[model samples]
Target: MQIKADSVEEYLANVPEERKEAFAKLRKTIVENLPSGFQECLSYGMVGYVIPKSIYPDGYHCDPSLPLPFMSIASQKNFVALYHSGIYADPDLLKWWQQEYPKHVKTKLDMGKSCVRFKNVKHIPYELIAELCEKMTPEDFINIYETNLQKK
Candidate 1:
């Protein structure tokens, strides 16, 4: 699942051929919905969308050297995982997702605070996922991150 690759392309190349198309489609949706100023790259052995250092000089609070992570997509052993930091930090967003996701997809919503696990590609709700991705701009995420850090 967590294939250690140097780049996004390499990560994708290593994914099983049967899973590649689904990953590509999900990646495309993520890219299309991502707000400007976020960079796509490999991070934590997954394809990560991040707020580049230029925008947030401090980078990720957990690791200042790394870019601020906004979202990520990775292939797991049994499921594909989609991570959205906004949903994890924003109660309203999480509530909205919990209420709305099941309406769009018949399957059970396999999700954690930040990660959504998809067992089948067809069961993924791209529209909902895109909507969630578009909920926060890089600036907005930085604001939230900083605020949360201050609280800690």
Candidate 2:
């Protein structure tokens, strides 16, 4: 099989027209909100935002290759996925998020780990996604992820 594109624009170009509008909005939202050190690229056929190894030379664990990514958004067979890194690292926020976020939320979405899934673009909560990004920072995320890794 062919490898997925590297840029989000290229990834969008490969998707069907019917799915474009929703993904367009989500992509715009993510681009507008992504922090410094984080960038948009396709990973495993999905749009992923992470600290490139060039920037985080030590990685999250001070290792050369380990990553402490912020979030990843993907359009799956049945749903649009929002993969939040803080879901595991920030328990307090996740507890509130689990309760306060809109109902009909889908969890346990595995794309190597967990993701929140939605069937339609409208179902994806742009605000909450924004909050998650704003709340989780690359530096703090690295520390938290490394701590968890040590725990395990």
Candidate 3:
């Protein structure tokens, strides 16, 4: 479920009415917690946090024209999703998130390689998300991203 919009505000405006408040809070949590160097923008039709071209001229490995994507939040058809590249790239981070999720939310974790799906907005764990956001800085991401890229 991609909302066609050019900016974060426009993207948020198109989110399903039922998810508006929770989505806003989720966005706010990410913006407030993510490190200072990451810039917020609309990327791949979602609200995204990225290391801008000025910081990482090489851009994304998959698509060098775009900035280095760190994370994204979207309201999908069935649920709201948070996509964190750091979690996908780091096994330790993934394990930590998996272990800590149950401590914050009782529901069984619904997750993908890099996406965390929140089916019930009320159960979204903002505090846990904040901790996840703080775990990596832009420099940390660039190093991890490049290190993994070289391995491939």
TM-score per candidate, chains pooled: 0.97, 0.79, 0.98
lDDT of 3 by residue, 1-152 (tens): 77999899899999999999999999999999998899999999899999999999999988999999999999999999999999999999999999999999999999999999999999999999999999999999999999999999
Query: Tens digits of per-residue lDDT for model 1 on 1-152?
Result: 57879999999998877789999999999999988999999989999999999988988877899999989999989888999999988788889999999899999989988999998988888898889888899988888888888899
Candidates' RMSD to native: 0.9, 3.7, 0.6
Best by lDDT: 3
Best by TM-score: 3
lDDT of 3: 0.96
Task: Give the residue spans of candidate 3 off by over 4 A.
Answer: none
- Residue 12 in candidate 3 has what lDDT? 92
Off by over 4 Å in 1: none
Error of 3 at 112 (Å): 0.4
Residue 71 displacement in candidate 3 (angstroms): 0.2
Q: CA shift at 58, candidate 1, in angstroms?
A: 0.6
Collision pairs in model 3: none
